[model samples]
Target: MLGSFRRRGCTCKKKRCTCGSMWYYRYDVTDPVTGKRKQKEAGGFATKPEAEEAAKNILAKLQNGTFIEEKDISFVAFTEQWKSIYEKSGKVKISTVDIRKAKLKIILKHFKEIKIKDITKLKYQEMLNSLFDKYAWKTICSVHETAGLIFRKAVELEVIATDITKGATVPKKQQTVEDLENGTEIPKYMEKEQLAKFLEIAQLFGNANDYPVFLTLAYTGLRGGELTALKWRDIDFKEQTISVTKTFYKKKEVKRTYILQPPKSKESKRIIDVDDKDKLVINTLRAHQAAQKVHDLKGDGNVFVNISQIKGQHLTTDDLSRRMKILLKLAELPSELTPHSLRHTHTSLCAEAGVSIDQIMQRLGHKDDQVTRNIYLHITKTRKKEASQKFADLMKSL
Candidate 1:
């Protein structure tokens, strides 16, 4: 359609004003979605040719079906909209949606209300690189994941032409010089000896449910969520293995109580063998089962159910952490250690005992995780040092 251009706020009274005010253009373009022609206008050109060139570019883009109408939406606002749409999509659990919301907050800190259309791949990478010093690699990755989803949805909605997160790189956090000198920073986990002491105190002073739960965690390396989802039927007392195929789900904001869902990933579904030689973990579980029988508290037969609570009251990962803290306080162990720390403990001790990393990965139901690999590497390195020291001692005797 033919369009018109003119200058605005010009005071010259001639048919053509020579006043140097900025130019504006008005044209009618078909709405790509509605197929209805609508008048659009833009201003702030310094000259007629510049304005005409801009109009021609817009017309060319529209003819090629590549025009993107500017939508006055902020990044944070669009992300919230996507978050809402995602929550209502029913593709994943509410708990997962909650996690996305948390990760999205980390991204929002860098791009609060910045226009979604304005973020290019370079800009996104800069934001990620800035996080390397402040956040752990996993946290940065999670933030990037959430950012990717938001941008994908933005692209799908035609808000932007390409996903800004597509080519962005997240820089891994590196160990500090002090960390190399003092050894890598210790993740929250107990040493083998410390775990023994913690379990001893748990068995001695803690409630009936405490020892078995922590012992199982330390021995099997089950995730806190996986443990909370365990049931009596999942345990094989005779075969001495525990099947893990599901996890506990919770979202307090949505009033979702504990529910059983599939394991976190396909690799998370596996069976873990109890130490059949010592029989401590299996016996502890057997004793726990017996006690439940005595109290007639076997409703639905969950393995990690808090028996001290009213019957059938389920245990969650949070509940396990709180109990672990109280027991740690009593045992004078590091209070910062969480129930998850037991999983790391299991990996470390297994590596020390000559269990191959591959076996440990399988037993722990992990495809691969950085923290798990770190524990394995650290323990294996220590073992290598011990081997060298022993050889030196033998040579000294010679």
Candidate 2:
């Protein structure tokens, strides 16, 4: 850190102009392009403490590839840059990165190629207001998050004087008559009938692992990552439960090649039962295990593998998604439903079958999941009405 007490300050914002009796600092970082050392400086700080703090942040961002020099950067361009840095940074989980990537795409549609320096809070909030009736509140919040991060970074890097996202309020979800009448407000998950039909379709049209995989997902409510990480040893036929100790973390997201990480929470590492009354999942699993021993298809490492064209490596959540799309297309079910939606589906169905909410949460390895609770409550409300009607009919008959 350097400070000039008598010397006139460079009084500059474009990197660091020298002569900061006002303090300034200089540092070296590797250039992203040339892969060689490059000098960088940030100045115009009024106090030594201020200069030191700015110096630390600027040096870190520059080293981490977050602060790149650009002129008149477009809003979309700034967002894309911010997203690139954000994803590369190790602060967030890989899934959050993917979510932010998608959210940014939605946000950019409104901002277009307008220069980032020109966007006002009024303008940014207008875009958010436009989204209120069109999207769910949760989805709009995600868009707000993506936009907020970009503008905040711009202020932090001194590209803009103020963050446009500050004090911006996202529009709340509005209810329509259709939402009330058709149960459209419920979160995405298969109904009991839709699930049964989807399972049958998978049995007939799915590839080798598809039937077992989807069935296991629906029956047991394991997260795609947790299920993908399971080994043959994780299953206990004697207890009729599957132990979920670790989850498969995608290697590109982490440093380790053998990327089995612990469960999402301590509660996530519990045993869940398998095999409903007609002995379906266990029988399917038994048959699946036998197929792994076949000479051509090596299926020994993980519980779920590529018995189809991909061959031996364990299946990824993305792979499961692609297969689900294909099966959903074949089955004529909702294309929007993801593998995780099946977790919600299991909660709803189990609730209807008289499984208590606590038991379902334990089985799904959730300490306290609002989504699961919502689905369970929705199912029980329906059951409550049915019971009320049944009592009314019995009284009328008497």
Candidate 3:
């Protein structure tokens, strides 16, 4: 009685109604706990035996207690669950998590209501194309990557039978020559004569606030964040060194909010030695400190405060960039140079001076000597040739 099939004839003008047609199956099952009768219907079977076998298998699964009810959870529901689990694990940093959350919101706007199983590879591709049409290829790729991660978690949790996102393709972005050349090629360094002329003009700007900050970045090779986070405690006038401990970022959600965190790596946290060549800069900082002391009587202690708002906090990265732009214009320097370019200039100057790679690595807080070597390879070759020529000159004198 649990498995039964019914044959139905097509309404065709045939003599015996012997033409093969659709068949239907019906099965009855009882809940083991509740003793309630449940009926299941399946149709479109070509033969009676096939219909009976399907019904028999269903009855067997019901009797054995191995039948699992498929859940119809939507894509949005799974994403929320995944995000909650990911946040609780604390594997990702807050800033990175915030970025991922933003990207997920964009994805949820389109495919949130669809069930996980309903998402086919074709549907995934269409979503990617939509994202690509609206945003940059890089952004579309980021969304694709994040979506894949979400689907992978769903598969791990058995929410879906498989990850449908795996078969989807991401479009490749076109890159300009400048984009590829960046970081691989170092811009020309300031010649000794250019350095002298630039410093002369730099001394003329002469403001205690902007000029000092610019000089500090150029002389110490500190990042804008590291420089902004500097405090009086970080400076050791007696030892002529500065300790880099923290970096800063402005949260995009709350524009004015500043977050202070450690540097990107262990190597970023190190001491920078100040040499006698920078005695002029040291003297200038001392004068600025005296001025800051008078201003801090009102109780603000940020080292790089805006001079007008002495009571206000130090400058942000945007503020530094704006100030640098103004200074570059005044110094008759090209607009192409950025604050980070000063870091490159510092490395180039040291390499050209015949400084050893190990010492340069320590000075620049680079964890990998290979990275330092790679960046300064051209300078190293020039230094090698100069050294060889010097040896020849000494031999001729002998």
Candidate 4:
């Protein structure tokens, strides 16, 4: 016995009995909450003084409110609370929210069983390095970003004093040679003779309903989404301009369904001028529309609709791309070209024809001339040669 009890000296009748010489301490106190008596005993000390000192330290901690009860809370429980707070107040997109959930699952699977304070930078670095080895650099970066966000939230909520991942270093990613290879294979533009041949093939093998779609893409430089969302009311034949206001997004799971949304940016909402050649193409479209009218399959307000149906429903990017691929195969064109390459070709043509950078930027719905220039910088040498030749011609004329 230590506190609240006096030590008793041993006095045994037998030979050298030491009943009270062993070092042990026992104390009794009342539980504040339950009003029950409680006994605390600790021992294995070499001396009575050591036992008494230990007993005194325990008593001081209890009186000073420094004793901490071991908590049963876990990392998973805290993370769930963090997620509820994030969702209610965060402005995260749905796709981004889903990605965060996935990253959270990976973290919980690896570290949730441990106490939050027990996690160290070395442990987080090891996990990040392992994941980096198996995943792409972008994916690894996303994981790091998501983990940092969670840890930051933890710090804000006093769940941890410091984020263990804050100082962890991710290894530099190795890039494969195949990733550096230039994959663009489409020609910038068809020469006059090539254009003639392409048109001949289009007339011979392409469906009448599909030719205008291809023509529109080649001339206007509209993205596939923008082309899919074009309506008849958006075309101003008298002004020879086409208004690009909206685009179609094909949902990942539903292939046929299209969701109409605004253009990617304010610059993308533009009015593109129709050239004389494109006007002829538009006339062909109108003739086709009239022909469909006789069969009671006229489209609603859409400039381009399914030829076989009269519904106002629009085409999806995937279906349009598939149709264009079939047409390209039938015309004996290279299979590597996609519908998007048509817009590339349009930009290339504008650059080669000595169009002003500003005009090209506007026509392509680029936010600034630098965007147009950056994409077509490979043509700078060609432009230089053209400029030199033009200067020579000007001098000769003078």
TM-score of each: 0.75, 0.59, 0.65, 0.59
The order by descending TM-score is 1, 3, 4, 2
Candidate 3 lDDT at 314 equals 73
State the lDDT of candidate 4 residue by residue for 1-398, as single tens digits.
24533233546666554564445566765666998877754444545666677678667766877533222357787778878877777565344566778788877877889766445565688788888667777677787887888778877766664576787776765556765586333354444354455556766787655767777787788899898788778887777788999888765556476667678767989999885764775676567656545333444566666644434456567757777678767767767777777776777777777677778778878877444565466555577888899999999997
Q: Clash number for every model?
A: 0, 1, 0, 1
Clashing residue pairs, backbone N/CA/C < 3 A, model 3 = none
List per-candidate RMSD values in Å.
Answer: 6.3, 11.2, 8.9, 12.8
Which ranges of candidate 4 are over 4 A from the true structure? 1-196, 275-278, 281-285, 288-300, 308-312, 368-375, 388-398
How high is the CA lDDT of each candidate model? Answer: 0.82, 0.78, 0.73, 0.68
Kindly list the per-residue Cα lDDT of model 3 for residues 107-200, writing each as its tens digit: 8888888877556565678788777667887788788888888888877776754576897888766678888877465564454455555556
Residues 313-393 of candidate 1: C-alpha lDDT, one tens digit per residue: 668777788788899999899878999889989988898899998899999888987778888888798779989999999
Clashes of 2: 1
- Cα deviation of 154, candidate 3, in Å: 3.4
Q: What lDDT does model 4 reach?
A: 0.68
Residue pairs in candidate 1 whose N, alpha carbon or C atoms collide under 3 angstroms: none
